[model samples]
Target: MYLKLLPFFPGRVCTIQDPLAAAVSFDGTVSTVSDTSCSYSAVQDGYSYNPDSYVYVDFDAHPTVSGFVDRTEHVFKDTGADPVTCPADDIQGCSFGPVTDKPKEINDVGTLALTTQLGSLTFNAILGVNQITTLYTDDTLLIFAPVSKFDELGGLCGEYNGDPADDLTIRDETVTTDAAAFVTDWKTDPNCVSTPARSMLRYHDQTSLCSGVPQETVSGFEGMCQDIISPHMNITDLAKDECLQILCICNDRDIGACEASLEEWFTTLGIVDQRKKDPLDLAIELQSAFL
Candidate 1:
């Protein structure tokens, strides 16, 4: 089972996308995403939320993409009435500027890596970024959709699933050279249950829940808020992770590395939430200010 979907793993994105998601995110029960964006929650079937399968949902439209590599796109194709016209050059800081490369392609371990050791170090790669994509929030796109919704879609995510409501015909791994036959086979199979962890991606804007309104969005470089940390710095985890990084390469032990990986090891290892004033009372203040 583990080896089967290895190719689809790179889609492992931070499940939760709360503006204040530097903290824990909740689907029904709150899930803890590591410092990086990757989330780990048990499936209804108790499968690991590793990247074996990724679900894509349109934040605005709630549709699947044409293919796994083609999760929903902010950019759409040109059609009759509404032709694909280029955006005015004056448009404000546009995210995902163009479809030069697939968003998942940049993942440290490529899609299959999510199931393996190399890309599992997802935390280190995602957190290190200081730039924000075109997303409205800092969290991964995965969390925006509820788990049930994620399950219904072929779990192809953006660039793939178009409408979860649409009948999904994509079936299992029966490779074919015939375009029509391959597409038919690909679309007819029951959406493969890759055991994705929708629970972990339960991120939502906490401004309304915590306070009522979203706080001024801040980033690490902006220095308005800081990522929260456990009162415990997780020293033991830190040591273990260092050891894993050094030794695992020689041993080919990915699971062991994950076990020993540092706290927030799966997600953000170093990046902290943007800075905030009165840092200690920030949580309470965030509630007071936003919620």
Candidate 2:
């Protein structure tokens, strides 16, 4: 955003015409005349008069043109109407001026990243189990949309068919013994049935969700989600079952009595509210915060 201060001529009682049309001359003089007056050399004690105009001294004109120049005049000239008089309070010392460049959009990664990782199969599985009721918050649901390829792949259901040997193939090659055991007995593991497992699964699901989301939305949520989930899973070497367990625990966590804990998590971190902030500003803020 750019701000231009009107030339402050304190104690000078001069009638203000179209300030936008006003231009500064090279010799530190301001002229409210047309462009024709720019080259005029006639000066009497630092003041000049047009062929058929009133006498006025010119003020020093800065070579660098203000962005407000011409714009203000254009509005008045085109409309052929008087400029709206701004109230003193409204025009207080400084006012917001025209924006020079486009603002950046803000995206929510929590919704996007989580949605991608939880592909249709794994996503549906969690929803099917309904063990971590809190994970189904409105914000979470907003983040969860049907992913086409994932839906096609049949997600977790296609990969895990109740057989330890077959399920073992679905696990990442670097999976640890404990992680392998968890996947081998996912059907009967008490921990797998609880919130920690749910959080872990949800976390993995969210990673996939991030990949599928729109770039803008993905940018918003990706970094923060990584920061929050980093301690639980080694993103570089993902272990499917282990990741799933972590997601379950996180998802099942209760953030006090608030149902909109997911949304609150963002707001609490000073993330911009999507509804209130400009999209570009939000994106920039998120990027800056994460960086």
Candidate 3:
């Protein structure tokens, strides 16, 4: 399954980890999605692009998957060209920033309304949703979003305000209405619609949050069950470790891909542990419900 890079195609598999490092390096739902993020990579505003109508990346010009492309200065950037605004000193490689802002066409596997919203983190950070440079000063581009757009993803970073989710919340979430407006702003932004990386993550985040797989099928819980109910007592030790493992995978932003891994892990565990008299059923059930 090779994703052919287009236009000035850099030929590198668009990765989630780099974008994440530019944003937040924490290990949470968003972080996991960031690390495992890999999209086919596309030039958002390429040939045949329509600002009025929706356009998506495809081997063929008429793609079934719909997403927005970047409409910013470097909106029409090609691997062949330099970033329109980047200075040579700021970026070492090419005129542009080595094609970091992916095109929406490449990562629109999940049916989504592609936009540049960063996710609930942006709203939680209260970084002024509208690409406020002074506030979002990290080297890599900052994607600003709200939980409604991120839906399920918000829960990952948006907890009861005291848990690990709080670590990422730099601002006050008490202002939910403003955060909601941020989500709208990002979605309507022409620039965000152009970049695939930003838009793809936004879509996947919402898709996962909105349409998560059934709890029992998630691999994290399944693996936990296998570990805890194992023939040996040390299984308990292993079960404790799976929380991070599953959650970490979920953070990659590709819910479907992570869910696939979870399903596989669970299938293998179910087969291997079929014979064991599992005392961890209750615990596993609890974890599974959360997934």
Candidate 4:
């Protein structure tokens, strides 16, 4: 999706896609969240060294389904370290600068809490309902959804609408097997070009690692990770995929690290879920048992 400019705040806009999304501009304006779609905004505090920034949140009863946010974009007057081209300004756009930090992910058990660079965003969930109360924040941007929407949403967070069958739903509402095409379809702006997906082909070794994994190992992990949701594929299937990726990167001697990464994968799967308990607690327990 595209980041739409907010008229109330100059140089500030809300993303129409990723739930854990952020788009920044050079212009001076406070950040906030608008009721458009899956979006977030940040307000820059007057501090120079640590200007506490915060994103506004909505407190609707029938809450919108915003997936977990893991993506951020910043617009700079000029290109700097690791620049990604943007359609608005050919100079620079979609920078992951420290202006906004990643929000800490929670699970779908009880309350909603997402920690951002600026501060914390928290909200209490109503009992037996799919909505949350007004969000209380310290100085951060956070997103949440009802437990009823668990794995029932889509967008930049992946094709996780509770269906493990189709994870690559593009912007045109079509399913694509091609990774580049999938990324391209999510772009709300036509002039914008997707990042160099093809350029990273050389580093991909998961294909080889996918083979020879024990079925019991996969089933066991999947059984323990039932709470986590896989965005692009079935949790069972994703377990295998993550297994391959983890194996590709971690050596045999680094089995503990691999287990830890797997535990992280499980926790991350529920990061966007709006129920309650911290995914890390489950992750820690899973690690203790499996590792």
Per-candidate TM equals: 0.20, 0.16, 0.22, 0.32
Query: TM-score of the candidate numbered 2?
Result: 0.16
List where candidate 2 sits over 4 angstroms from the true fold.
Answer: 1-165, 168-212, 231-291
lDDT of 1 by residue, 1-291 (tens): 000000111111223222111112111212211121121121111122222323212212112211111112222111111111112221222231232211322233321101111213211111102111111111222222222333332222211222212221223322222222322222212333222221121122222122322233212211211112232223333222222222222132232322332233323322222111225321232224222
- Model-by-model lDDT, in order? 0.21, 0.21, 0.24, 0.28
Candidate ranking under TM-score, highest first, comes to 4, 3, 1, 2
Worst 10-residue lDDT window, candidate 1? 1-10
Task: Give the range of the ten consecutive residues with the poorest summed lDDT in model 3.
Answer: 1-10
lDDT of 2: 0.21
Q: What is the C-alpha RMSD of each candidate to the true structure, in Å?
A: 19.1, 31.6, 18.9, 17.4
Which candidate number maximizes TM-score? 4
lDDT of 4 by residue, 1-291 (tens): 112111111111122222322221111111112223322222211112121222222211112333222223321111111211112111112222111222211223322222121112222111111231111121121222323433433333233333423545555456665545544443334455434222111112334432455656555544434433343224544344444433433332344443543444333223322222434432232224222
TM-score of candidate 3 against the unseen true structure: 0.22
lDDT of 2 by residue, 73-139 (tens): 1000001112111111122111223111222111221111111112121110011110110011111
Comparing candidate 2 with candidate 3, which one achieves the higher TM-score?
Answer: 3
Model 3 accuracy (lDDT, Cα): 0.24
Q: Which stretches of candidate 3 lie over 4 Å from their true place?
A: 1-174, 177-180, 186-213, 219-256, 259-291
> Of the pair 1 and 3, which is ahead by TM-score?
3
Model 4, TM vs. native: 0.32
Best by lDDT: 4
